[model samples]
Target: MAFTLGSLVLLCGISGLLTGVWSATIVPVKGNNCPKGWTQLDCYCYIYEDERRTFADAENVCNILGGNLVSIHSDLENALVLELSEAGGVAPGGGIWIGLTDAVSEDDFMWTDGSNVDFTNFSGGEAGDDDGDCVAMVTDTGEWVDDICAIPLPYVCIRETFRH
Candidate 1:
């Protein structure tokens, strides 16, 4: 949707007389904007790295690829990522690192992307330990596990789908 400063000013100018009735065009973004080798989902792109790497190393790799570790916000997104990773044959007990971490404070997880963490899917007895600071998702259930940051594991990365 196109926004004009004049329109906003006019709306503000009329706020005293009006009772909150206004309208604006809502624009829809096109899909298929993710980079090659990344899967487009909503406005974000995701990729599952099969190679084992420490949480820090995985984050660095993601940074080099123009993104950070994936931060899941919904069940649908979690399921989608798990499906994609399972396509590469990750076993049930095997896990893939995500962006959640509590390295600074035990049991206080935060996303690397710096977005609001409104959703979480920690498994039973998980994310409660001080030693397990980093997070990984079990490929079979898409549930979370709190593991040490130094443990090597596969990981996922996500970034906004670029627009032309």
Candidate 2:
């Protein structure tokens, strides 16, 4: 196992390449490439569907459209979603299903998009057991509340902006 100069150089080069690869940060590209009828915010595109459907059904629809139910991670994002739903003609007092749920473990909510639950807009005493596992945003105030998954409601969907 004698080390040769060429072999040592090659090993060092490979190690350096791996280090560069591992340390690279993926910065999302912000562009105006969202699909038609979808609104772009940051790196994501969002859309609201006024059709009333149960949580599962709404999620299915979103999946069919190449996304998942919207996941709000900040107040600005939450307000944008609320605005999108309202502009799309959500009935007053009606709710719109979001992607948060604790179905796997009650009270431990997670977003279906696999994004971190870094923010929430729940109303007072929400994420409680008074309702079921699903979460819905009350159109009146854009506040979230737990609700039964079987309840039909409008929904918002989101996906990363695509480059065309």
Candidate 3:
């Protein structure tokens, strides 16, 4: 019996298939580990923009990238976002627009994606501000702060890996 290169390759392939040794490619998940220029923590992708923009404009940019301003779900997620913002040189009290807003109803904060509110990181007496309707993350405390949606400020964008 002669074993040619092709035959060996075929046999190996078959063996792998039979033994289930071959697996599908594991594409990177956004929330788990984001791609270049994006940070991933669980299954969401986060991108921080150092340049300031109005809350609406920032959210538009995120939309162009197929994501929305970050909608935090847990403290861990909020912490990760805070870290990303800090790494980008966003100082404490520095504002970064997130997907949170109460534009729909005063004091009725909601994520831009229409996701129901699950968790919040509001600073002491933050959402109480009467002049603001949009939410931004304060790098100093990783707490939620309401600001005027039209005010330009650095912001973070978030999207699900499945969207991309």
The whole-model C-alpha lDDT of candidate 3 against the native structure comes to 0.83
Tens digits of lDDT, candidate 2, 1-164: 34685587667668778776433333558556788999999889999998899999999999999999999999899999999989999977889999999999888899998889889888884565666899999998999999999999999999888966
Q: Any runs in candidate 1 off by more than 4 Å, and if so which?
A: 1-31
Residue 43 of model 3 has an lDDT of 73
Query: How well is each residue in 51-136 modelled by candidate 1, as lDDT tens digits?
Result: 99999999999999999999999999999889878986788879999999988877677899898788899887456554688999
Residue-wise C-alpha lDDT for candidate 3, range 27-80, written one tens digit per residue = 445343465798766677888888899988998999998889889898898888
RMSD of each: 8.0, 10.6, 6.2
Candidate 3's TM-score: 0.76
Model 3: pairs clashing at backbone N, Cα or C within 3 Å: 31-42, 31-43, 31-44, 32-42
What ranges in model 2 sit over 4 Å off? 1-31
What is the overall TM-score of model 1 with all chains considered together?
0.78
Error of 1 at 30 (Å): 7.0
Task: Count backbone overlaps in model 2.
Answer: 0
Q: Sorted by lDDT, highest first, which candidate order results?
A: 2, 1, 3
The 10-residue segment of model 3 with minimum total lDDT is: 23-32
> Which is the winner by TM-score between candidate 2 and candidate 3?
2
- TM-score of model 2 (CA atoms): 0.78
